[model samples]
Target: MNGLHLIAELHDCKCAPRLLRSVDALRELCLTICAAPGLTPVGQVFHQFGSAKAPAGATGAVILAESHLAVHTWPELNAVTLDLYVCNFSQDNSVAARSACARLIDAFIPERVEQREIVRGSCPK
Candidate 1:
């Protein structure tokens, strides 16, 4: 195993107050992360919830050759929660995971964050 998975919870994102309420931005972010180095995207699915209602949010998932990346947004609270998971079948894909995570984080520009990087299927027990 030689893969990496990163989980991040972004709080108080400025753009979440304006842009992330729509599913388009969420889908775009997922695609961008999928295109990161050393990763291959096989498919993707995104759903927009309450877009025309009193409150709004977006949920998206990108299927990759290695594994998947997912994101959920709560625009009313100005927050976004993300998960990036990649598996290494032929070679290590840790660096690519990190690079992609950074790009997503930069897009949100959160005022506070809770982040973790985990070795997925890469730890030998």
Candidate 2:
């Protein structure tokens, strides 16, 4: 199956602190982002690293029909990592994947970003 994998490292985020440290906030934002790009989310999972009294970063994954989206945050470092992969079996999903990835990057409002697009499983030019 031909697929696209989007990876990004975000640094010095300027977004709301809750988005970086709150589990619920991150989960909601992720799910919403997926849908806007016409990506079908089949299932999801999220976790908070620290306690409510002293909240830390969160991690989550949204399982999609085409593939999945994984996100990890580090409030202490003001950083985030995002990975989204979508396989094009019956139809091409590359456009949607890129859209979703860009939206997520924007949401974080990172001052500096390192991003890459990898075509997997023998892609055509």
Candidate 3:
């Protein structure tokens, strides 16, 4: 399956603290980004790490028709990691994937961002 995978590490995120700790907020953001870039969301799951009063962070995955988007947040460290992949089986989805990834990074507004791009299954079969 030819695809594009985007990885990003957000360090010292400057967004609202609530965004870092709230599962609802994270889930909503992930889903919304998918839509903006025209990615199909078939299903989703998000989980909060700790109690509300002393929350840790959140982790979630949005399974997409093209591929998937996964996010892990560390509120205590003001950090986040994002993974987005889109398979180009029927059509090239790289642009959409990049757009979605960029939206996520923009939302976090981190002081520093570490990013990588991996080309998957591109070799001729």
lDDT of 3 by residue, 8-57 (tens): 99999999988899999999999999999799999999999999788889
Two-way lDDT contest, 2 vs 3, winner: 2
For each candidate in the order shown, give its overall lDDT on alpha carbons.
0.82, 0.96, 0.94
TM-score of each: 0.88, 0.97, 0.96
Q: What is the C-alpha local distance difference test score of candidate 3? A: 0.94
lDDT of 2 by residue, 1-125 (tens): 78999999999999999999999999999999999989999999999999998889999999999999999999998999999999998789999999999999999999999999999998655
Model 2 residue 36 CA deviation (Å) reads 0.4
How far out, in Å, is residue 99 in model 2? 0.5
lDDT of 1 by residue, 20-120 (tens): 77787778767866685767888999888884664388888989887889999888788999999887777677788888888888889999999998875
Off by over 4 Å in 2: 123-125
Better-scoring candidate (TM-score), 2 or 3: 2
Model 1 lDDT at residue 48: 84
- Give the residue spans of candidate 1 off by over 4 A: 16-18, 53-55, 122-125
